[model samples]
Target: MMAERLRHDGVLVVGAGLAGLSAALAAAPAKVLLLTEAPLNHGCSSAWAQGGVAAALSADDAPELHAEDTVAAGAGLVDPEAARLLAAEGPAAVRRLAALGAPFDQRADGGFAQSLEAAHSKARVARVKGDQAGRAIMEAVTVAALAAPHIQVKTGAKLVGLLQDATGRIRGVLARIDGQPVEIAAKAVILAAGGIGGLYAVTTTPAELKGEGLGLAAMAGAVIADPEFVQFHPTAIDIGRDPAPLATEALRGEGAKLLDGAGRPFMANYHPAAELAPRDVVARAIHAERAVRGGAFLDAREAVGAHFPEEFPAVFAACMGGGIDPRVQPIPVAPACHYHMGGIATDMDGRTSLPGLYAAGECASTGVHGANRLASNSLLEAAVFGERAGRAARDERPASGPYAVVTAPELPDEALQTLRQAMSREAGVVRDAEGLGRLMLLIGDLEARHGRAASLAAARLVAACALNRRESRGGHFRADFPEAAAPDRTFVTLDRIDPAGLRYAAE
Candidate 1:
């Protein structure tokens, strides 16, 4: 039977986040189709970001400094070339966003109003209003994308698998649009579908992003790199919300202190950088604080004070919604799963292990964020690599071909809840051999029950890799192996998840 395929002549971008949208926009005049699980301006982490993009745009700062900071923050295993690419081309990406009408905050002197974030060497994070950079930038980009003539947006399309031609080259995806399975064949497939934040019980990302792109690519035989390194944001507002709201790290950069339940400042006791410490440090600190009787909190009253609404609208609204006043009450905070530093391995030009398969943004581990990611670099990476992927795919349109449809396993609600609980309990902020082994057991059980669900597939990759690595480094902290060993990075394919090997060689 002929595949029920939807064929597009140009590039097919699987996702509508910063990377996907940016790719579509960059692949101008080429017929670009963006397949998203959500509508134009919703369900993407990019829209929820508050700290804004990091670039060496300030006159006093340099890209070399930014690159140094990125390497320092990545713990070990950060690719020098990726950091160089991000640092060198980041300013241009931000400039292009500005030209596209992004409402970035500007100084009185008319330059970008950049702010300091944790682990960054300088105040290089550009903002919008105060904490509205992500939403504002995405809104502007969405407007531009909608106006673009060559781009087509397909909302409500969920990708399940990748398609391959007879020669085993990448072509497109198998997606379910409006609940109907359909094959999509294109010249090149760009997987910008974000990360695995939604797989955790508590996260700062939309629940829809359950590692779909990463899982799909892995299932299609792409080289998955560093799947064990997951970054937990230190200050997710602990308001008992499903997708916890974030207290922008810029608040800490502006002097907000991390406190405990007894209204005592605590970050200074943990790290010299205190609240401005690296994200992993802060997250572990918060987790340790919570482990103690004193629960973690982010006290930004002194930082934003009466200007909370203007300086951080999203946080102000979330606090108000949760019946907390940021001016008086120290917002309850905890380490929530915020970002994934590991994903489908790709190159500087966004080429994955498979030909015609490319990835950018959170889904692609371009070796930029090795074990831990620098604050505000995620958005910069999306812009820099997304454009590269777009330009690469623009003229590489392949011959139209057939595709295969592989549907996701039908996971019951209870099984998903079990998976979430297991992920949080075992793979949350810290890890150990026992916990990882238990996690693998649960993943195996879930796989047996659900028959290869994409979420479980991705979750298993993380657990299996985390189980194999025996040293603490970057975002991956093993309580059993608290010492950092020789620096290394993990590279795994689909068949190796039962037991993935770690490599110490440079890529």
Candidate 2:
């Protein structure tokens, strides 16, 4: 079918999460067209984030300390320069949101209230009334984006393909709107689509985020970095929900305990810091406990029992809806895919390897998240690098040439479910050569049957990369290898991947 073509002499932004909204807002007087697959405050992970934004906000903390924690959590592959930049700009990013009417909780001295999470040396996470940070922050940003004079938003517009010129420069996007194809042209395009959590059967993110943006960029020959590293949040409330509700790590920082089904604390046996250990350590410990014991649970009865309603209302409500009052009973927990540390490789300004295209938020890897992400830094990266992407993208001169849309076949629902289950089984918290090889075979079979859908492409990248790395480091753990190798990052373009079978390729 022929696509209906439209042209707008400005910048086009994809996805309506924090990153896309921030980019559109920062574009200022320049006209901005923002497109999303769902309504504002829906489908994006930003609104579901419970732990709040990480920043060096308190008197005792500095950006250097925050950077140190970020690097430590990333497990040796973090770029020091990018980590420093993210930490240094994090404070101002949090304050900027507050200025835009985000209702962040404050202290008696009118300072922003903070909380400590796993791996942070200081109480640096600036939050709302506990778990309400993502929702509250998104509400404020939504209002601002809607009110911005230069920004026009089109909700329910699903991105399907990228429009590129002959020289390999991105010119615009091909979107499906109301079941019809529409090609929208612009000077520059910023992709802020969320992560690949939907690829796993059990994840803490919305089901719509299947890494389409990452896949589209890769198919267009953009560099993908560390696609193997997938972060599993240690404590997703396992209430038989499709997308599990996350019990924020801040609960642990607030003194929650990880206990086996036998009612015994087990984190002490896993690491010295016990409940305060880094997220990767805690997640693996929980995974091991769930295998030995019937299940693992987060016990907050002694920590925030009566204060649950006031402090973590979101979690409290979710637990109640799931027929468990968090105040009295322990919340059933599991390691669920929470974040993707790898994505379309970009610089601090969100500039991708491909010209005329930029990326931000979870879809863009600025190297701050390395092998694993530090807690609460996702939102900060969205605001800081997103603003830079907007400012940089706005300067692109208009191009007047014929552009072609790169399209991929859509996978059916059943096939998607099959892929998701395999991902959680083979590529979940702990990985091995056998499981990874099986996953690659499964991906190849699915693609052969359904063609190279974006979801499959993204899944293939993760499986192939995980299969090749052969060492346990951070989120991409290999039980067979069982140890860390010399620190190095994986970078690949889609063209380098073998089309017929399971294989890893490089630049």
On lDDT, the candidate that comes out on top is 2
Off by over 4 Å in 2: 505-507
Tens digit per residue, CA lDDT, model 1, 236-285: 99999999999999999899988888889988998899999999999999
Candidate 2, overall lDDT?
0.93
**Candidate 2: residue pairs that collide:** none
Minimum summed lDDT over a 10-residue window in model 2 is located at 498-507
Off by over 4 Å in 1: 1-3, 400-403, 499-507
CA lDDT for candidate 1 = 0.88
CA lDDT of 200 in candidate 1?
93
What lDDT does candidate 2 reach at residue 137?
Answer: 98
Q: Give the TM-score of candidate 1.
A: 0.96
